[model samples]
Target: MTDIELGALLADASQAAAYFVDIHDRAALVEAANALDFTVAAANLAAADDKDALLEQIAEALQFPATFGGNWDALVDSLGDLSWLPAPGYVLLLDHCTDLRDAAPDDFATLLDILDEAASAHARAGVPFWALLPVTSPDA
Candidate 1:
């Protein structure tokens, strides 16, 4: 389990922003969400290896509708339009972000941009959207 506090996470999460939790175990993070005592929209993007794959996985995980176009513009359009979430915020547990980052750095950056922009949009609407990103292992 993450040492991170659920209440604090929720408090920060409530403001509508994207967060990348730095824990390796994505499931533990979900457990933390459970302790949050409220609904949390979650998406597991473990198989997304590239930009298009990532986009499609994200769309499916976040419950994007059938009409969702798998493109940058469509991504931004649909991200802020998640009426099905029904929670204070949304969390994307990306276990393979590091691998994707290594193989497709530019794509990873674009993904970050999209997530940040979406989070900002949700913030404007008083909801939080977080990206729980895991870090590469430390050498120390």
Candidate 2:
């Protein structure tokens, strides 16, 4: 989707959800989220072929608190309660995840599940939380 389209979709807290985006549209995605006053954060998973690396990259990207425990529960907790990086909304860009998705499909699926859970939580609280995953192919 175009940035304008993305911005429009992101404006609705109740409709917030995870989405697959064109990898080439990274800049536009960030700009769109920023335009909507969303706290945009990105996790580059290019080098993250395993769950440990995935968690590390996400923690670093989102600037999780020092208390972060570096685990799935910690990720869910942090993503659900992003009080440290407060904003009107949130947009997480998970970039270049194809490798991880291929090398560790289970972990990738779990990550998506956690993200969806967080999105649902935010939606219930009347806040927008979008997770944008950039993939090389439409089928990805």
What tens-digit string does per-residue lDDT give for candidate 2 at 6-105?
7888878878878788777778878888898889988999899999999999999889999999899999999999999989899988888888988999
Please state the error at residue 104 of candidate 2 in Å. 0.5
Candidate 1 Cα outliers beyond 4 Å, as residue runs: 1-4, 13-16, 24-28, 37-46, 136-140
Best prediction by lDDT: 2
lDDT of 1 by residue, 40-125 (tens): 44445566678788888787777788898899899889877888667766666665566677778898888788888987887777
Candidates' TM-scores? 0.78, 0.93
